[model samples]
Target: MTWNCRGVGSKKFERGLRFLIQERNPDVIGLLETRVNFARAGEIFQKLGFKTWVAVPGMGFSGGIWVAWRDEVGCFVEKENAQYVHLRFSGQGQKDWLATIAYVCPRDKEKQHFWDDMAQFAQITQEPWVLLGDLNDIMAENEKKGGAPCNSRRCELFAERVSNCNLLDLGASGNRFTWKGPLIPGYERVYERLDRGLCNPSWRCLFQNAVVKNLTRLSCSDHNPLLLCSNDSGYGFGPRPFRFEAMWLMHSEFDAMLKGCWKGEGGLKNRLMNLQPNLLQWNKEVFQHIQNRKRKLLARIDGIQRKISNFNRPSWALINLEADLQKELEEVLHQEEVLWYQKSRGQWVNDGDRNTKFYHIRTVSRRRRNKIVMLRDVNGDWVEDQVALRQMAKDFYVDLYSEFHEETVQEKSLFDNCTVSFPSLQTEELCSMNREITKEEIKDAIFSIGAFKAPGEDGFPAVFFQRKWHIVGEDVVKYVFHLWQDLEDLKEINNTLLVLIPKVDRPDSLKQMRPLDYVM
Candidate 1:
């Protein structure tokens, strides 16, 4: 839990802290703006049942940060500054992870140093990481209300730092604003969401179902505490649909597999349909080998560690073997990173950052955001059951497209009376618009589109054609030529998948969704 405890030395703040610790029983607690000396902070930590604690002294009683955790959780301080405390933690059977508790200075000039420190830390750390606390900043304009408007430049810089660090906002529930100013009238009641939880991609992978909730503000403090909870069993357990990964193109055997599958097809579409089954089989047999190798490497590393621990002095040969295994493990991990990075579809993040954690979080966040947890039906009733929700969406969309009403004569006449005109095109302009598509133009058009986009109904993206152009180019060009020349109904090629995106935060009704057409 992260909280800005205005001043821990005060009786009211102390009482609030005690109540919070007793009520939540969190494994770790990070407090900012404590405004107390180290000795007093130590006494409070001891009384609060924290066996290990660290505190950074405040600047003349205006700012102080403290991080405390129970003895059961193994925690070691890795780094600390006036603005943040970084710690490495490990527990029984759990992977070691990093946590940084930060409290940014309210002053604008000091914020840059805080961001610089964080960026440096992110660059050096390679473990699962979570950074939480009051950033003293807002990411969006709407995050603040009743102020002289949040500094747009400041918010942009803050957002850029988050992106550069490869962090994803774990999105909070409960109150929209985490910090409130004095309740003065005349546009003085400032409110902002200054506190949030941000984590790296690895942390999201480890705690895939984690949620950050901004609890109600305590009476003694203006800031609300954020509670991070992990619900491991909340994710869907259904079998995942097969997706052709862009990373697979990097493999030596991918081209061979495609060539083998393409040899036995009829039309372009039929060939693709038949090739899918073979590709699925290849994924299971060949692509899955990478994961299998990872598991074997992990087993070998564990076995070697056990042997080294048992020996009084490990032999040189054992050390060499461990180093080799570690190197191979790192390479396998990089491959896995590439696989997830391609799957994430996060184009904003740079490729060299090795932001597998960011990619993992993006995928998880998208899944969670898109999930229909509950829906309001036509009868104005909320439906929670998965089958019921599915039926509701299905019925809503089906009726939307299937039901058609004939236009009345009066309504038809409204359009008939309306006249629209445009300037006439010159002969040269007309000729240019009517010109036939060249082979080079078709190739350029296909290449110009994003190669890693989501596939349409045919289950193929532009990348497939671009990568296997040598084998499939002739059929594709011929099909395009015929379609352009004949100008006939191409219903199969024209088929599209309709995807619904929410137009507002927390859309409960079908009318709130906007449809996007994904043409095959």
Candidate 2:
């Protein structure tokens, strides 16, 4: 669930990694070379839901480390040697465990002292640990991309120390390299497989199903960050629900209707629950049917319309009846001759005038008469037919309504969280105690709450601590005001009397505001 990603002191890369952490919402994030002051690092990690600890002495560009875990997690930071952070996790009715993250300098002449310091750390812990970071050594040439020979001294030293300490190098699969240099004009991509994760046997079992993928280089950093996924066997696949634009769906029109409903004003949770069932049932039984019917009807109506338009030809019977229909034909023919004369020469002389005028009148008369005769015999509908047009418009809107608003059963169940565990990793009681917790307690609880896995809904936002409120006992708000005169973050947003009491028999003093004035 956690790994040491050498951010390489790139602010842009760090920002991208921070974005990923926020998106994934991980419980623990082990980062190195954060290139930030300890206070800034703490603030950044805290916003992302982790209680962070940074290495001291501000080595500037030389090197630094940061370990961040959820507030409820228990941990200890040993800064004496090699800067190892030991983390522990404790849960009700379950055995407790520990994990660790550190950045060990490569075993080269320049950085031999740091590697030596790690040996002492390994000796002291004497417990299961998962150590991860950039060790600056290649285990084998095959592990690197375009790699030459391995750094034998550093590699042999790291391997011997880890093996002697009973640590297993949990090698990455599906990847041959972890770090890559920037693009050069003429040279091939320079790469080094430096970052790694090594764990004790105990940690191995927990990470047996874990995956670490080399993600794309987010910024200008040479190293592509690794994505660590654990307890995610069923994370990717599921019956995803149909999602509608809630903001669009609940427009001003739906606002009044929603407000009038009991569930609408309660909160987002209540409104969703109210809409879920109706959508689910509609989606299950009617959505697809409506879509198919709409398509078919549209196709059929289009065909009928096209046929009416394309089959507009006068029949022989109509032409033969022209003599019997001489009066009607003459009237239409005269109107056409008048139109042609006016459009051609602004004169209404018609066939009795010039030869050119007569020819024009004959041509126009034949075309006009042909159209009128076709309508009278084969397909002559000149009026708008308002009723039929209106029916078609109504059907189109009705079909659109079904296609958009209908919800499905499967989608409803997805939001409902049918298979979810409760109480979070840190139970309510523990979480209450951890709020505004001491640095020592923060360190001690790192692993329990960090490694303790649960779906997001189980977790409570850190915002709860930004304001003081009642959780367990009555008159708690009064105590908060009495103790902290200026608790800025812990401000009261709202307050309500759980039960109203009859006041006629009470003293007038009880009705008057006193210390209660500030709270109200």
lDDT of 1 at 124: 85
288-330 in candidate 2: lDDT tens per residue? 2333544554555455455555667855554444433454334
lDDT of each: 0.80, 0.46
Could you estimate the TM-score for every candidate?
0.60, 0.40
The lDDT of model 2 is 0.46
lDDT of 1 by residue, 315-358 (tens): 78878999999987787677777677667776754644677756
Each prediction's Cα RMSD? 8.7, 36.8
In candidate 2, where is summed lDDT lowest over 10 consecutive residues? Answer: 369-378
- Please state the error at residue 485 of candidate 1 in Å: 14
Clashes of each: 2, 19
